[model samples]
Target chain A: MPALIEAKNVTKIFGGGLLDKSRTVALKDFSFQIDSDNPSVTSIVGESGSGKTTLARMLLGLAAPTEGEVLYNGKNLEKLGGSDRRQFLRDVQVIFQDPFEVYNPFYRIDHVLETPIKNFKLADTEKGRRDLMIESLEAVGIRPEEILGRFPHELSGGQRQRIMVARALLLRPKLIIADEPVSMVDASLRATILGSLLRLNREFGISLIYITHDLTTAFQVSEDIMVLYRGSLAEAGDVDQVVRHPEHPYTRLLVGSIPLPDPDLPWEGERAIGRPAGELGVQGDEYCQFHDRCPYAMPMCVQTHPPLFHTHPNRVTSCYLYRESPELPMPQMTSIFKSSNREGPPEETEQLDALDAELEVSQENSSTPTSADD
Target chain B: MVEETLSAEEPTAAELKETLKVEDLHVYFHTAAGAVKAVNGVSFSLKSGERFGLVGESGSGKSTIALSLLRLIKPPGKIEGGHVFLNGTDLVTLTEEQMRRKRLDEIALVAQGAMNSLNPVRRIRDQFILAYKDHDIDVKRSGLEERIGDLLTRVGLNREVANMFPHELSGGMKQRVCIALAISLSPSVIIADEPTSALDVVVQWQVMDTLRSVQEDLGASVILIGHDMGLMAQFVDRLGVMYAGKLVEIATVRDMFGDPLHPYGQMLIASLPSLESRKARLEGIPGITPSLLNPPSGCPFHTRCPKVMDHCSSVTPILQEVRPDHWVACHLYEEA
Candidate 1:
């Protein structure tokens, strides 16, 4: 059987019109597949401008990719017609980031739950539709009587978001793409929302694409994880392996930056503030996107961008350090490594030294204890 | 009147000279429905050069307390029956002109969203200049420019950033600029209300790092208001857990995380997803935060408190010293 949804080397570029000179490559050559036979949770982790949202938009067929194609059930998403389009829409669903803005202020909250059932013809009578709504709401731990007649404003953020989850469950979609569903909710309520989503994946065999900036929640819910940096895949693997021992430098930085809840495990070491802004999505495919900020950056990173090299049986990282992996296709560009060693040129070394000196000065100026060990 | 309870700690005279002290703060908004008690009898103190954290869910009145400190509460929202003593001076009793001088010069606020805080049409330098002029700083144009450059550099931004507009800067850069402006006068206290909420995690860490460094250099007390428990655990020396506009618990960072006194605090800590280990299910605190307009008769959290006693709904618990440094206002501790 074919995958539920698949993207084949998709590339999305925004704003390269005749008048507009700057072209932003929102998403690079990305490919992934969710199998229909085996339902699993895959998390797409990235920063704000890292194109996580753009990928979600493309997968939902809301935006067309500039190059390559997005396929639902092995058919091009853009080309689906009649029954195929309707089936695709029914199977695939989305939960947006902000629950406050999703609802229509004029309508009662019941309208949100009733519309999906009416449009899909899941229930013939009003009573059948009401029963379906009540079941879905109770599945997510929400009392139907308390939430049925209330307006969107009457409910708390957590309640509104849980209702959205119930709305998604009304259709029993095969796949749910939740983009930062709990980011707006309270810290204590986050677990409640995520717990229900995890239930959807387990009790019901639904695949999930959990897109968020938070690694902790992603690790809790996702089986597989993909780390994106500036529209490029940094690392992808089993959630445990990738989070515990990150291969790519970008992934390492992201893992290090997470403020763990345990006060005993305070953040140690002088965390290098990663690169300045304004250079996002501007670099071409010629050079690695993370070269400027990467601590393990070498001349090879500047010379050519690295492809996803299989590091382990379950892991793939787009870093030159893993280029020696047996699964990597060694072809035309082997000559580039011969031109430069790890220590490339005197000028490049000097530039790195200058950056080091700047960091040192800022560290010294602070005069606080640099590490927790002290 | 709450000052008497603070004396129960039995500190030295030197220790009593706190940089900022709030006692019996009750701020309410008289809306059409009724009087919405946003902040009810909340009290805390900040020592010089200390980092104190105020954490709660949205509408728990953490931001309202911050605004009350600066006397920024407007007409509809009244700071009803409270005394905000900043350096031995009660700020609530001060005139508008006196409060204006205290703001940015003595106590500064780094607002929630940095995107809208800065002036869109003006350069960063011009904004800094305007602040200096409003405060009536006697300095030459070149000296002001040099001071602005120094402030920007302290927050890890280049001096060239002063020449650019707010739109040209990224979210992190805008936050850094806001930090720079807040610390321009070397205020004794800085209230950063969710300064990094809009930025990504990486940028959030970076911006927080900058804020910490600048704060250390100035030896200023910081009232960090945010709902992220992980951030509070790492950054703050003391933590205050607010519920339904009241401070349900207050303790040192180590004590609060290791052993939270209140039921709500414990649930909050348990609910946080950890990188160290993954649990089968997180124990989220059941029941919604109570509506402050018509709050619960006695204990604000009794509606959701798992360990609540019969008297919890009929009798209010006063915040008192349960341990040496730990303070809690719950019936469970009251019996002890």
Candidate 2:
């Protein structure tokens, strides 16, 4: 079976003109595939400058890659004919981060739901369009009675986003590119919007490209995970395996930063590898992008960039530690000690223990507020 | 000698008295639609060095409360009735000039989207100087650069960052600058509303660390306002769950997370997706927060509360002490 979407050794470079001297590589020889028959969810997890957005834009055909090509059903997306382009658009849909921007303030929510239905001719009559709108709206947990004829300002952010989802559902696209869909929405309503996307994935067999920096939510929703670090692929594998045992140093940092909900399970040990300061993407292009911040940075890391090594059957990590042949006994976390000889494990543990034992009590607990002063 | 004499009596007063105390605070927005009760009879207190979290979804009036604390609520919105006692002085009754002086010196706000709070046109140093001059700080023109550099370094930024414009800095850097500025004056209370909401996770961790260290170093109370329950669990000392302009529950982070008493608080905690556990779907709180213009009679959350009783809809429940430090405003726990 042909893949639904495939990126073949794609690269995107920005700014190499008079206004800009240094070129920023948003994606470096990136390649990935989504099987059309299987149609599962894939999360492109990355930080702010991780080039996940660039990949999404390329996949949507909104932006072209500098090299390689994004293929849809074994056909190049850039080379698609007018008719094929229309079909491709119908097959693929995008849900943006901000819902407020999706709709106009002057128009009613009905305009959003109506456009897709009218353009696609998903329904024949006015009654059919109304029915389709209601069905799609209900699918995203929005009541047509409450939302119809209501302006964008009248509805909440979550409600507006659900309407966007409902609008997407009206097309019944084969794939949905949701770029931080729930990040802008409040936490309470986050699950509902995410649930709707999951429903579209499972129930409707729609493949989803869920892009977010939040690993926890990505792990919760996606089957496959792709971890990116400053335009470079760090690790990619099954969500369960990758989240449990992240191989890449950048992936480990991302996973370690996730704050757990349990108060007793305080964040301790294995701090995030801080981003190296001064001029991003200015480091040697041949060297490992994460070498500066990697806790286990080896001397060879500066000399050569590591290829994507298959650590497990499903897991792939682009790190020198998991190289095919031994370079230097997989550089231990000795670099930290080498940099700061005074600081050791004992002091770190002591600080962790003290922080863990810090009381949840406030100073006002022992004394009452001065309400009498009023 | 004079400074030593004044500082001698400050320790006991700081320890004994609350840094910020808000009692029966009510703020209403007089919109063309109607009177919107943003905050209604909400009372909470933060100690000198306490880290307090105000958690609620959009329209829960949590942000409104934060704004009301700093007296930043603009027109159309009026402070209806309340006593915001910052160091035993009722701020509601204070004159505009007195409040302006008291605003930055006594209580400062690191407003939500603080990255955008900085003027893009001006350099970071000029903004810091402008803020410093507003409160009439004694930093001379020559020494201001060094002072700005010190503040920038405290927030983990390089001294050269003070010379750059807000546009030159990334979102995280801008947020750190905002954090640095909020604590520059060494205010007694810092209301950081959604401080890390817009930043990346790793950046958020660093920004949070910066806030904690600065807050500790300055011995300032922090009112951290955000809807991220997981973040609050790791960051805050106390948690307050708000629903429809009322604080439904307030307790230590331990008790609130371990055993949430109120239904709203319980549901809020249960709804959070944990990173450790891979629960497929979250049991989200049902129904939207009611319209504040004409909120539901009595209990605002009764419309959505799973453990709703007949009397809950008709009678307003006052916040009562359940556990030693835990307070709940639900009728179900009234007898207990």
Candidate 3:
């Protein structure tokens, strides 16, 4: 079976000025395909400004790519406008990262839940729509009465998120772009929301595009995974394979950085090694997108960028080391990926967390720390 | 796995202890609606160089206990009743002046949301300098800058970052700075309230490792408050399971995972999703945690607990040390 959603060499550049006039590359030479045949999930993992969100937006046809193409069922997404676009929207709904921000505090939960049912004409009569609404809520593990007349604030963070999932379920979209759906929720409830995604994928066979920063959750649900770094494909492959034996340096750093709560683990007991730098993106061609920050960057990496190369069967990575440039020595980038003050507009840490939470790839909201702080 | 029960009267003293002991701590926030009992009759002790974990759902009052420890619980939240003792001295009896002198020197806190804990306008180093001044750490100007740099380095950051404002760094770095601040005075106990809960997987990894090594090196007992059970399992020595406003279980990290006595703890462990088991559909805890204001008749967990007996709904169970070290406040384990 062919890929359900394919972004062939899709690239996007957002300039402060008009499209062609400015010189900022938000996404560069991005390429991947999500198979819809068996209803598997594809997780795009990266830190903030990695162009993961930009890619998601583009995939949903919310934003157009600067170069290459995104096709849905072999049909170009950018060209789909009007009722066709509406159908595309109906088939591919997004479960936003922050459920609190997604809804209005003043509006009752019914308003957000009912909008899609009414807009899509999912139900003919009042009783039908009401039953459909309750079923959707029940499917997402929320009771009809619990969500009936409550405001977003009246619900717990996790409850609000379940409501978001229920609202998306009401549409019964084939593909869901859930960006960091569980990041803001409490720890205990996160697994359930994640479980809902798994349940949806298995039972309903809904193809899921789970954007997250957490690798463990990605490991739990995704069949195939793509690791994004600074708007470039760091690595992509099978979930179990890539996660257990990461091919790329970036993926390795990400897996190594996930801190578990148990203290006996070897990974948790190691001393921290924090190297430092500023502003992650590359302005000039000199630095590898990961240069200055990658633990395994070469001097050559700073002067030239690496192209994505086939390594393990299904995996691909863009690093000079993979090319076996024996003549060049690896100069580590100050860090790998850490949740830093780098992405947000907030001067305080609270706002930084809010910003970190935007939309994590698939279901993981991973971060970049100076991997050097090993 | 049954446990041995010990009464509160038996002082935990056989071992040379400079531990902070909290007894029947009840904290209530006078919200607009009513007096919200945030930390209702909670008790725990931190031994020297021991790492303790406070695990709970939202509104379980873990953070409230942390805030109450430092007297940082803001307006509306009053320490209604409880005795908090640090080392041998009771902090509840101390005046504001004494607490000010003792805070950073004896007990430092790395609060949740790293950046908010840091001052945005002031240079990140100034936050350290201010701490030094506040705690009366006597060192010359030249020596102070180096100390600040060293502190940054200790927390795994560049000394150069000391010159940068909080905004210039990333979330992980800012959190490291918070840990750096918590360690500046070399306190006996460092309370990290939800340190890794805010960061991404990568940053969370970096932050957790940084904290683990830092706590080990300093030999200070740590009180880690987190909602992530996976993280709690990996990072803590002992775990406290809180429900509503009460601590229902306290056990070693291994015991908590291996033999969870409380119904809440068992449900939490059973519900957790792991990388190893993809097919395991988590048994979600049946009902929502009860409202703290008007909690259940007896046990806070009885509403959602699967093993609730008839007597449980009427009689409040006092915290009994069911094992040598593990404590539980459940009637099901009454004879354990």
Clashes (backbone N, CA, C under 3 Å), per candidate, total 0, 0, 55
- Candidate 3 residues lying further than 4 Å off, grouped into runs, are A1-4, A16-24, A35-37, A73-76, A261-263, A268-305, A311-313, A319-374, B1-13, B136-142
Which model, 1 or 2, shows the larger DockQ?
1
Arrange candidates, best DockQ first: 1, 2, 3
Best by TM-score: 1
DockQ of each: 0.32, 0.28, 0.25
Cα lDDT of model 2 by residue, B160-184, tens digit = 9988999889888899899888888
Residue A147, model 3, lDDT: 60
What is the TM-score (0 to 1) of chain A in model 1? Answer: 0.84
- Candidate that beats the other on DockQ, 1 or 3, i.e. the better one: 1
| Candidate 3 positional error at A252, Å | 1.9
Instruction: Please list the C-alpha lDDT of all candidates, in the order they appear.
Output: 0.81, 0.77, 0.73
Instruction: After the best TM-score superposition of candidate 3, give how far the Cα of residue A17 lies from its true spot, in angstroms.
Output: 8.3
lDDT of 3 by residue, B141-171 (tens): 6788888888888888989998899999988
Best by lDDT: 1
Q: After aligning candidate 3 to the native by TM-score, how far in Å is the CA of B128 from where it should be?
A: 2.6
Which candidate leads in DockQ? 1
Per-residue lDDT for A78-148 in model 2, tens only?
99998888889998999999997988888888998888888888889999999999988776666677779
